[model samples]
Target chain A: MTALMIINMRNILSVIMLGGIYSLISAILFVVLDAVDVAFTEAAVGAGISTVLFLSAFAITGKHHDLKRRNHFPALLAVLVMGAGLMYSTLDMPAWGDAEAPVHQHVAPRYLEDSYAEVGVPNIVTSVLASYRGFDTLGEVTVVFTALIAVLLLLGAIREDEDQS
Target chain B: MKKNPILRETSHVLIPVILLFALYVQFHGDYGPGGGFQAGVIFASGIILYVLLHGIKKTEKIISLQTTKLLAALGLLIYCAVGVAGMLLGGLFLEYNVLAADPVAGQHWGILFIELGVGITVASVILAVFYAFAKFEK
Candidate 1:
């Protein structure tokens, strides 16, 4: 919450730093929840790589943004409305770690029961990710590939133009 | 940025260890909490650290932008090829059961290869993007 407030400030570097800290904290939260894989990913990508990437991009852009104060009431109202809606929806959600939650009752049991027999991996997450949901992982890889290609096309074009001149 | 011998020396010692840890994370994911994505990010951060300490120019000479681009494509190709190989073996696309005599063994192989592909592509693409951003000002 404090990090969100800090992010609203004008300094870009501090905002990025705070964002990284927020991610790191969330990763710790994930660890406390026994989601070690998620914590690993959040720490590596969110806190580590993204902070460096932001700094690199910042080198190309400006370090500070022009803060022009305008009417923020509409945005605040929208956020409040959305927050209220989300809160209302959460009331219907099962309590945290409830055994009879819809998710735990559904496919989780099947994965837990048969993953080792079918996929032969001790880590159920890997078995599920790489074997059971192979297509989805492929699509994720393609998305990463597309993002890289987009960045290359955007920035590499500029380099080519400069070299030609 | 001023050149500091301390920074350079520390990085020189640290980078290899970081890279080794990434490899451990990558291959050890079968039993542990990490896989390609986490390992890839860690690996890329190691390279980024090298770039920070030794300068982008020197780092680029070692791992060229062209090579990074190729690696990104090659990784994707490796993944697609594994799927195609499964198809050729008369399984559905990305179906690992037909890749070997034993279905479970085939799955293990398939997962390893695909994870390797994921790791390679992610690491290279990230490094390439970083290079593009860093080189834009030059």
Candidate 2:
């Protein structure tokens, strides 16, 4: 498995590359699920930009991690328990793409039916996010701006000296 | 690597194509799967590709870090301004119905502007973060 390879690799660069590969595969899986927008986002953000960032960070830090053999039992046990718990929780969920599912019975129908009449956009996703749910999109933009500020502060890139005021 | 003719020539061919694709993804979202977020990441990836090939300093000369930082804030401003504009037009905050003569037209305009704002912020922020990472000295 890609996750296994990524975890086992001592070379940090290889691990980072493998992480990108894992995300790329996940993006493809999204495409298979017909979540094309999500697939595009995952491919670009997860596989593309993040991989470059990882590589840049790798350039700053040295090549490889310490390769000391460590006991994996505790980590393995934790992972198994978490996976089992998650799988057990999914047992109570509705079948995949079931029309009678609570999610389908919710506001999805209204969005699918009336969004075109109201928003006039062929893409219901766009209408839902940008028109019907405009406030959320604004919040998302604010979050992106906040993230930039946080990264700049953390990286010492926030210069306070020079100002035109 | 910058001097290598193959890499240089290939980049010349690819960069514009990448940028064009980003634009397509942005404007075609009404009819397609992509929108602002994906388009922004694609745009940033193009810039990152240029940085990877050409040196960072050279790339920064074209689009400075200060500009990107400003643009990131500008994106959020644009989004808020749209919401405020909607409120001023006799509607609730972020209400697109009052944006134009027709409610549908107003929605279209609102979505377009917000997507543009989202695209700008996402692209600039990602690029700015990459610049930070690149500039950090061990």
lDDT of each: 0.89, 0.88
Full-model lDDT, candidate 1: 0.89
What TM-score would you give candidate 1 relative to the actual structure? Answer: 0.95
Model 2 achieves a DockQ score of 0.83
Name the runs in model 2 displaced over 4 angstroms.
A160-165
> How much is the TM-score of the A chain of model 1?
0.91
Candidate 1 CAPRI classification by DockQ: medium
Report lDDT (Cα) of residue A89, candidate 2.
98
By summed lDDT, the worst window of 10 consecutive residues in model 1 chain A runs over A156-165
lDDT of 1 by residue, A1-165 (tens): 857677477787888888899899999999999889999999999999999999888877774775877998999999999999999999999998888889898788999999999989898988899899999999999999999989988887436645756
Q: How high is the DockQ of candidate 1?
A: 0.76
- Measured against the true chain A, the candidates' chain A TM-scores are 0.91, 0.90
What 10-residue stretch in candidate 2 chain B is worst by lDDT?
B129-138
> In model 2 chain A, which range of ten residues has the least summed lDDT?
A156-165
Among the numbered candidates, top DockQ falls to: 2
